[model samples]
Target: MAEGEEVKNKQVLFRNYIDGFPKESDMYISTGNTIRLKLPQGSNGVLVKNLVLSCDPFMLFLMRKSDDSGLFGCYTPDSPITGYGVAKILDSGNPKFQKGDLVWGMPGITACAGFYVVSTPKKGETVFVSAASGGVGQLVGQLAKYFPEGIDIYFENVGGKMLNAAILNMRNHGRFSAFDYLVHYSQFYDILLPFIREGKIVYIEDVTEGLEKTPAALVGLFSGRNIGKQMIVVSRE
Candidate 1:
């Protein structure tokens, strides 16, 4: 569609407040909504066409109404569930962004523009990354591989057995970066893009087709049924 045109917005909506482990019944696809392509006058928001979405384990916590202290706001019942996505800007009222700008960031978080500094990895230090195959973990694993001592980083996504094993095998002075405890998205992309372009990183995605499968895909994370990065393909284009 052209710029400033109206389009139907397909969204995954949170059906109710979740408790314990969330089920597929907790969320549903709502495709009856339409949104204008342009941002309202005086609004600083940018309108975007989402291209890719990230499925992180932390999303389960946001689904729970009890967890109000999360850095990302809790999902409201009957509202569209929001998360990080790579998108193409369709229209913008913000001076920093314009139509066709490709970007990625969480719904409530501001996109990081300009350059971000990342710490240089020491030559021989071992790095342990939990959720190594997940969105963030995969990038961390690839970055660690670039060091002279290759694959020294232990990248894991799940806890329990995997985390215990990682702790048991950690070398003295080894560094551990937890996905839930860090905010290094910009730095991650900085290092990740090069590897991606060089074909150094191989990504495995477990995708469920259609927005209707979103809840099932999410619930599968807890059951260990998903392989690699779990995602929902809402559209082919």
Candidate 2:
């Protein structure tokens, strides 16, 4: 790919707002799109080549024409949709990133993305979440390993057995929490801050703060407006 080369940018476009369960017919994949491979003049954006596109359930919520789609907002009637994706930067106008940087984007917490895409966690299931002094959420950094067969992110911490187990027991949208191997003596409650920051776990699950925002927050539980356990705080005191 040369500089400023244009490539076919295939996309999925939602038909319209919905009232119930979204079906395949509600969205259409249009392969007739074209995108330039370079940044616009004076633009400071990075152009990425999406190596893997995750099909998540929150997209269904965004498909609805709603006033409260939380922080992510709603998808346009005829525009392309967005979700968690692993991609390589093809061009960069930002100083922090150079060409060929692999990135996993944000508002990307593990449990919420899981519950939406994979449904509820069950009893007798072996699930592990790592706590690096607690309060960790988001795809803050790219996991050290990338499985080319489409297991988008990974970091080896436990050992080869844990590593092999992860690779073998994979599913679409499966997420692994990061382990801070060095923190051996910290208390459990240290997780509150970052959780409060990015929104996850008990500190945040579909969390909507304040009284004026209560109604929309309530509606979000089943409306795809809320990400995790929906809670509205009228007052902290």
Candidate 3:
């Protein structure tokens, strides 16, 4: 360490373990646990300079104490919060990555300090993001547009006329999914069931608020939430 040099980090910290549903009060933000410019010589990792952090609904589910399914256990209470983000690399011992490279991926808790860390976004296929302007929605929207065929592919929003337009413009044999921003069960079932039942849609995907609440997530999809691909943001972000 040199004189006048300083190390500081700002992070979201958990205040306590949560059970059941959580509110904003369940967490807090603090400044601490920063790192130096250099890491261990033999360590195989990249030190990232974060630019953006993605706050997602799924991050909420991970806050649960018993995610033996290998989900929530990754998070701990009263610790520096970690989630996916987009970042630039500042240093690396890993051959696959180099400083100055941009990537969007998950950075393990404390994996990189100073700047936020993330993996490179995945490649391939068209992605339709609902509420595309939202925190998580924005990242997905950009990715869909950047995909090789983004220009040719349609990026649809899932509300009012947007949903109708997306469904109408979809390529034949193409798969369609959705992100449920509104937690309404009846509207989905009563409003969209006809289109789905008629094969106007190939498939659907969603992350809702429950297991017992699954019925509602699928209420509009027919058959009480058809069973191809379904999920919900079961945690707090």
Candidate 4:
């Protein structure tokens, strides 16, 4: 295929603005769209073919209608819902990325960095990380291993009872680092590079194949039905 050629794009669309917990019905797959295979002229964007789409809890907040107080805008009805994903670049106008480059990160958002600055874990200090099994939580747990004391950090994804228990177990002057799903941490890659290269972290993914299963994959995150990081496989290659 020639570069810049247009092709049919199967997309997962957000049906409407959600108020409470989002259901599978809140999203739908649409096949009537097509996109250019190349980036726009003078644009610095990279065109990617999504291979895996992450279903995260933070997406629930983006499903809501944009309010004055919210920092991230809501997903538009009848448009493709966006999130972090693993993708293969098809074409690129961006200098940093090139065709066939495999990448994963949230689009249009600053790459998460600076976790080391705020929550520098001290050796032997007890740390408690909420949502430990989820995507972010899983990383936090693995990263905690870098501290002189391993497994001292209490990590779990479920809230409510878990939060209460974590708090009750807090030691004197225990520093609590609260992670907001909406906030992206700077220096994220910098902190994880060594761990990733060393294979110190193991990633568990709950993958649902096809765009049609995207809605269910996302909804499963809320019901605790997914065993690991929930994701939808849009394409294998």
* TM-score winner: 4
What C-alpha lDDT, on a 0 to 100 scale, does residue 231 get in candidate 4? 84
Off by over 4 Å in 4: 1-4, 40-44, 66-71, 106-115, 134-159, 181-187
Candidate 4 minimal-lDDT segment of 10 residues: 107-116
* Whole-model lDDT, model 3: 0.47
Candidate 4: global Cα-lDDT? Answer: 0.69
Question: What's the distance in Å from true for residue 97, model 2?
Answer: 0.6
Model 2 alpha-carbon drift over 4 Å, by segment: 106-237
195 in model 2: Cα distance from truth in Å?
17
Which sequence of candidate numbers ranks them by lDDT, best first? 4, 1, 2, 3
Number of the predicted model whose lDDT against the real structure is largest: 4
C-alpha lDDT score of every prediction, in listed order = 0.66, 0.52, 0.47, 0.69
Give the CA lDDT, 0 to 100, for residue 10 in model 4.
89
lDDT, residue 78, model 4: 85
Return whichever of 1 and 2 wins on lDDT. Answer: 1
lDDT of 4 by residue, 139-206 (tens): 43344244434333444445666555555565545554444434543445555767768998676778
Compared with the true structure, model 4 gives a TM-score of 0.77
